[model samples]
Target: MTQTVSIADLMSLSGVTFGTSGARGLVSAMTDRICFAYTCGFLQHLENIGQFAPGSHVAIAGDLRPSSSRIMAACAAAIHHKGGHVDFCGFVPSPAVAAYGFARGIASLMVTGSHIPDDRNGIKFNRNDGEVLKSDELGIRAQNITLPDLFDDEDMLGEPTPLGPLIDVATAYVARYVDAFGTEALRGLRLGIYEHSAVGRDILVRLVEQLGGEAYRLGRSETFIPVDTEAVRPEDQALARQWTSELNLDAILSTDGDSDRPLLADESGTWIRGDILGILCARALGIKAVATPVSCNSAAELSGLFDTVSRTRIGSPFVIEAMNNLINAGQVTVCGYEANGGFLLGAEVRLENTRLSALPTRDAVLPILAALVDARRQDVSLSMLQRQLPARYTFSERLQNYPTAQSRALIAHLEAGSEAEILARLTATFGGIAGEVDGIDLTDGLRIHFAGGDIIHLRPSGNAPELRCYTESDTSERSVANNAKALEVVRDLVIG
Candidate 1:
């Protein structure tokens, strides 16, 4: 047919739009035609920027979701149609194929919806260097792709050519850690790998044993299980406690689908909050400068470990951008982590005998190993080690199905006037919970500081039509309580 498709029009028509991590949509909406056109637009934009060339190679991988394989095949077909070869690093973590593509100076893609349910899927794109930034996304949206007549009227491909030979990226992924931390990093630790359909399940279990840890595989599942690291599921919470006690384990570890964000629980079976775990991991790595989201707990600055702290919007791209700025400003030993617990190394780190190289993308294994090895070196439980940081507990929850336009309106109402007027309005909004407002920050969201030191932050989700609220207090119970109360207030304000 040789049809010319506008990326923006396709996104709106197919309901598959780009998010913080990738282009995600319902499985029904992500047809072969949409996926193929999206991939073409991505490659075309990269070529325009000189990051991709004709006949270059591209790597592809995916999670264990049933829909991922089909979506990945469409992406591979697009690569071949665009004169690029498919490396086909099948069924690997997002970070693994990204590393391979970066090392080989080629573009890459991962077909996964991250922590979202299996009804949805996504394709995460990366350049030769790192993930596609906001500018790259804009470039892709502005691009026009030529579509072939291979797809049916229903936008489905009829058995596209099979992907190429599988490249073993997991071995190199495992070696990345082993080479940096040695084989005996966790010689005396007992760990649990919760293998609930994560693409890297076997790889994580193998890596744990290879690093000298007694590893147990728990809850292995044939079905795709969506695990969100930020908000631990109630059943998963119970499972971690039971696993720790039954296995006499020191810690339990897992990650979200595609194995990018980390999920770690202490000996008490209590899942460590991702932001808190991030602080401990940064400290263990001797990070001198840190870039984190504004919604993350303020423990990074409170710990007094880093020479500089950069607070950014709630996404990896923003954190990466801030990290690059820190490096450009002459600060070394830089790193970044998300509230979801994915850690990014911004520069090389020199340990006593080994050095860890910079990998700017979010990684699950690095922070998991860092925490385990640091705990061993300190001869303390993960709980005790966490207590060494400042006393702050945070809770986050989101109002699903909330309209993004309404969420923006709420924030705008709170920030609609001069400084004093805004303070007066905020006091009116939050005075029932705590006494007057102490201060407010408009960075990425509406964050309010109360007179009594409690904090409330509200922001719209970048990946979905939802409103998220974060509350921080001196104790975990209070933090959770405050969050519930804040959401109640939000509901009352909006629904009424």
Candidate 2:
């Protein structure tokens, strides 16, 4: 019999902990043993919950990060040791692996750090049904998992070579959209794909071509690139403009490292905010109910496009849970998305004989494809379709290496006193441009609403040591300016 181990002890030794997205930590901190232990713990939890059985198949995939392969191998070893077989999905998007595995009622895992820097990495676990929720995390942590050191002298792991890919998950994912939307869904649309280092870069291009659109692959990189859809780099913005003029493209599309959160630009190279993209996607699919995180823009509520809108904390699992609740309440057409443009379909719907199955997880492809298709059907530019929404814009940025504890301290200080006192304290840094503090929402973070409809929300990134600030205004310029101002103030506060 295998020696039993404490899951909490392994986490403490590895310094890896659960975040809003997954279990993330520095690469140096995540040794092979740590990864193996965590995998075993996750498996043991699933077994306890009857989600897994001995000799069952567990699919795995990874992103383009250098350390991903090694970590994936360790996870494969863990699966084999736990009496499960590994069906390597190769390098693919997180959603693709999840889609294939969830369809077969099997578990899956993705080794990725998302848009975080190369120094960090993470593992996202998915149950047979969908993403692992907070309760699942607790169950995993509570499992007693033991690991024996195979290499006693050196810090290394047993090499558990993964089996070959069982099937082409990428192709299957592509077929999902092409079959639903038809082969000529995006016919005559010229699109640019910022390949970068996203795992789904090639698949995205293939999908465009399969839909009868022209795809121009740009910015392909051999090295891992951290492309945060939330905080797009200045160079990327400039490149989108240059590409638009040169290619005369209808739009530019891309995603982060794992390709779950999308970055979409209009014909003029203007990047549309992800929440706006979510609204457009829902409208395109004719969804009647939408579930999104509190960090998303209020445009969804103001648009009146959906019969029901539910707001949850900032995470896919929360959105999925909310969407499931709506579905259980007898809503046939339900969907969910994040501010990063990751969409989730919660129900099977038929549109003129095209039936789409529910995919209740963050997916970059669905939103990008939906937005482009919607624009084509309307015979309008992507920018024009965006203009139909309410006149609200959002901007976000982050201060890297900022401690989460410090962020909480600052929030506690600001939220400590009465409304008048809080106003005086905040106005000292923000000035009167923010107007008076109308209200404060502490849903997942500290969100402050001003009397003039300007809003500023501050929160620590769940996966990284960073302080994130989000601002919204009636005009795009104001939103952009306020984000910068808020970051500057946050920087000063940290330094002081």
Candidate 3:
């Protein structure tokens, strides 16, 4: 007789841990059993709300991890057993799943841990329109799920359906880039791509070549490497330096695991933060209306290029919400994305005739493509273009180990205090107050603005146990330093 795992035991699996972004844990901890039950529950909830129509077709995609395929199969099987037709997209970027969902008029399930380790895996669910919200997750969890036996081999397995011929999604995506800025604009530029483990590697190389620019591919990794564009450690810097030296390249570009986050390196071999890239991309696109996360660097507004600036809570879902509102209200023509520098074009804001209608999710291809074209058009280097932007320092740091309850309480306490009194108290303790912005935003988290273009936004990771604190300023050095100091002050008050 095969042993059965209890629901409590399944939930204890390592993959069950929630992060600020999504659910993620080790594959062993997130067993096939857990995936099936969670998927069943999620689908049932969709059925209840009429989100999952009878015979509705859904798209499934995964990353390059060894376990991704298995998890994708498991989730697809669950959907199939429930009478939903599955259109498998195979291994692709996270945003591609979102784009497919929007384009094909079906919901999407992406199996990826994003920038996490190879041993870890997670799932991101998108409705027919976009990513599922927190409220949706709550509804799914409340649904009654009949957990299947882990060892019940016959009943648990579903028919294996092969995905049709590999779709050249990258080709379609590249065309969108060309449409945004003419191909003639990027002529005669030399670009390098660090393929590593990113799914967008070949696509990025092809994009540059098609644009009439010389392109080189480097640093291809065999193992599933997790690359975080926002937090580049010394090792990543070293690798980038070696690639620059060997390729004699003008710029180096790459993306994280699923290619939703973009990474860029200057000729000098220094990695540019995502927030800085967002500001630069906005300038290159020449858009006056913009919306970004509160955690983003304040340099966006300091550029003096934008006519309307709106700040939302972290996460693309929230950013997309703001973008949709702007589109509906006719306040902006374009939307800007800064979650690690990957910009979502017309698709993000959903324009009818623009190049973005083809893709409505975050993509690493567009910003780099546009920026390269801009550089060639102006006859300037990538770094030179970045330097032309306004000088502002922005720094971000996180305090781990703070309980969710405690973090919320601390934000509530800060908000309840008078703005003047709180500023004076913080100034007295941390030195002097530069400025202050009153009110708390519960949409994503708590964001407090200080005078002189410095900002501190505090929130618990929706998917994890850690707390995230984002800071920004005018100079790079000051931004990094201030972020450290601000995190220290906040940590003391919250934990102590």
Q: Lowest lDDT 10-mer window, candidate 2?
A: 151-160
Query: What is candidate 2's lDDT per residue for 151-192, written digit by digit as tens?
Result: 333446645566665567888999999998888988998899
Indicate which candidate wins on lDDT.
Answer: 1
- Tell me the tens digit of each residue's lDDT in model 3 across 38-128: 6776677778877787699878888888888878878876787678887877777777767867877778888888876676788877777
Candidate 3 clash figure, as a count: 21
Cα RMSD to native, each candidate? 1.4, 1.7, 4.3
State candidate 2's TM-score.
0.97
TM-score of 1: 0.97
Candidate 1 lDDT, tens digit per residue, 1-496? Answer: 7899899999999889997898998899999999999999999999998987768999999999999989999999999999999999989999999999989899999999999889989999999898888888999999998898898879999887699899999999999898888889889888999999988889899899889888999999999898988777889999999999988999998999999999989998898998998898889888999999988888888888989999998888888899999999998899999989999888889887989888889899988889888988989999998899999998888887888889999998888889999989888888887668989988888999998989999998776678989889889998888888888888889422
lDDT of 2 at 360: 83
**TM-scores, in order shown?**
0.97, 0.97, 0.84
Backbone Cα, N, C clashes tallied per candidate: 0, 2, 21
Order the candidate numbers by TM-score, best to worst.
Answer: 1, 2, 3
